[model samples]
Target: MNGCRWMLAVVLAALPVVAVAGCSSAPPPPPPESRAGRPDRGAMLIAQYGCGSCHTVPGIDRADGLVGPPLTRFGARSYIAGELPNNADNLQRWITDPQAVEPGTAMPKLGVSAIDAQDIAAYLYTLD
Candidate 1:
């Protein structure tokens, strides 16, 4: 009985150490936003461009406009403006030139620069 009790106590005492050893010791990877683009900057640009006036964008203040489709879950969407495939490149292109992608799209050419478009696309992808 004494031997069994001693063994059980030893095992219990080592349990915490064993559990900790099994966990990863290295730092975690960067977030998807960082790898994809500057989502933070994108959000700011979206507001600056008055995108909220047309689309109901999450995370942006007063972004509850009903003119265009809501931008919720934009990251999970399969298409952009129901035309181009929803990818970072395609999104940037669409943002920069909506008329070029869809000739009659209600979304006008906002004159978004390439770098700004990249950041906006990055921010939209974070909606997922």
Candidate 2:
């Protein structure tokens, strides 16, 4: 009976330590927007927006139009439309309003919302 009581006490004492160790071993959670711009969602949005009608985007069905430059390996590019630097913010801006970035550019203003633009940019970045 004494041995059983000692074993129970040991087990109870170790519970909190084990719980703490488990928590400490886990990586911290990422920021809210860290994964908000998911590539899968972005791809769907691109197809829904008919972006494939102009740019040939990989992994999207019927994205073979030649009106605009092919988006293959777009993530490796250094610039957007050969104008603004290729980055998340710039890409979002260009997607939301192309004319604002370049007055005479052929790209039209699709009026994409900020979140959608972010998702699209995220998907584009995966092209690399």
| Tens-place lDDT digits, model 1, residues 8-44 | 9999999999889778675643232324668899999
TM-score of 2: 0.71
Candidate 1 lDDT score relative to the true structure = 0.86
| Runs off by more than 4 Å, candidate 1 | 1-36
Alpha-carbon local distance difference test for all models: 0.86, 0.85
After superposing candidate 2, which stretches have Cα over 4 Å from the reference?
1-36
Which tens-of-lDDT digit does each residue in 16-43 have in candidate 2? Answer: 9999999899775322222348889999
Best by TM-score: 1
Clashing pairs in 1: none
Worst 10 residues of 1 by lDDT: 26-35
